[model samples]
Target: MDVDPLLTQARQLWIELAGAPVAFPTRGVAVVASAESSTCPPGWVGIVALGDAAICTVPTDDLVGVVTRACHMLPVAALTDPERLAAVLPVTQVLGPATLAYCDDHSYRPQRRQPIEQLPVHHPDLVDFLASVPAEDAAECGLTDITSAAYVLRAGTAIVAAAGYRHWPRRVAHLSVLTAPSRRGRGLARAVAGAATADSLADGLVPQWRARPAASRRVARALGFRELGAQLSVRVGGSDQTRLGPGSNTTAP
Candidate 1:
């Protein structure tokens, strides 16, 4: 109910330990006991309480362990201990999917690399872009509109990199940026991310970042988004009884 207090507290902890950029909280989400608040940035979507006592509003898994240390919390029980669902929260009722992870935003620092000229959507180019990344990974990343996705090129032929963003309510926008393994270390990721950030800022939508691996947090830090903390999204049966935090008894052991 009172997520702000936890969000505020997480912000302070994230900055101190994670060296993350700055991050904000989103609205309309339940707040865990440790999180300061549920209010997030226009692009960010949810607020997750970290074990180390931070709240992640952005998309950085790097800090999950950090939070665990601080909060004396365990790794997401859902993934590791699926049967332990009842221990954390009730599984019978409508407890949202307990997909928990730590997150944070890096302050947006301008990328110092040379810019890549924008290229229009060419079906071949889009296919090429998709081909560069692992097929399954790409799908998992939610690459549906290859034509609408943004890309960077080199030598006028090679589809070096690409990224995409999707909009959500509460001013939240999702980010999915990818670079070819061969073309990495060339700032292509940053270029695509810059495009997404510019668009979000222009539209006044808060970008909710969810980096799959821990390394991607660097990209967010360079962009000026701060770290919010981790979150747990549990989707159980459609019932009001399944809620997170200390007061909410819906959670199982």
Candidate 2:
């Protein structure tokens, strides 16, 4: 199957984030050890798949053995070398099969946006709003100075929904959006997400939305994101023991 050009670009951006050598094949799984600090979630590995190939980024080559085992859980049809993945690592610890989605300039379409307020992280109202939401939600939107930009929709003094992006390699924007529990099903999520995405595109960055919620995926589609592929993460213990399951408890992006 032919890989989407945008998906290919997204994979390359991830490889760059890993600080892997440019000579690394963009289409296969490899064990790369980089001293660089990862921008990805803590203890979570990243896998970018397109057509029949995948690029898996682990924090260190020491984890490569376990990463290969986790890759076995991926759908065979999606991997370029399932046999190799199975052969390399022991089937001991596997953590997840998370879905990752991406959107580029061509793939995104602006939706009818709501009246959103772009705010600095230090804005009093934004700060108060973050406090009102779950801590995980606040952190995901970069409450700690990680996002380059943020936008929120409010009902008077109360923030109903918010979205933002963090700087990722190759000018890619890692997008995150959240809607208050009581305010969901009102299109507020899409409204704020659309606003943030528009800003990212305006700044010449490709917005990437990675999450597992079907509702989140719907919001992404409404804003013109395409499902690129799924990622699998495995936890490697100190002694090479592996554990396999879903991702840890965290708010959806």
- lDDT of all the models against the reference? 0.44, 0.63
Give the residue spans of candidate 2 off by over 4 A: 1-3, 22-28, 35-46, 58-96, 141-143, 239-253
Off by over 4 Å in 1: 1-47, 50-107, 117-122, 145-149, 233-253
Q: When superposed on Cα atoms, how far off is each prediction in RMSD?
A: 12.1, 5.0
Question: Candidate 2's residue-wise lDDT over 139-203, tens digit each?
Answer: 55443443655688889878777777777678877777778777888898888888878888889
Q: Which pairs of residues have clashing backbones in candidate 2?
A: 52-80, 93-242, 93-243, 94-243, 94-244, 94-245, 95-245
Best candidate according to TM-score? 2
User: What lDDT score is found at residue 77 in candidate 1?
Assistant: 24
Candidate 2 lands at a TM-score of: 0.76
Clash count for candidate 1 is 67
Report the C-alpha lDDT of model 1 over 1-253, residue by residue, as the tens digit.
4555324543443333222343333422212221222223222222344433323332234434433342233343232232453354333422232222222233345555555555444557766766767776555444443223454555467766666555533444556666766666766677776676665656765554555354466666566655544433333233232223211111010
Error of model 2, residue 54, in angstroms? 1.2
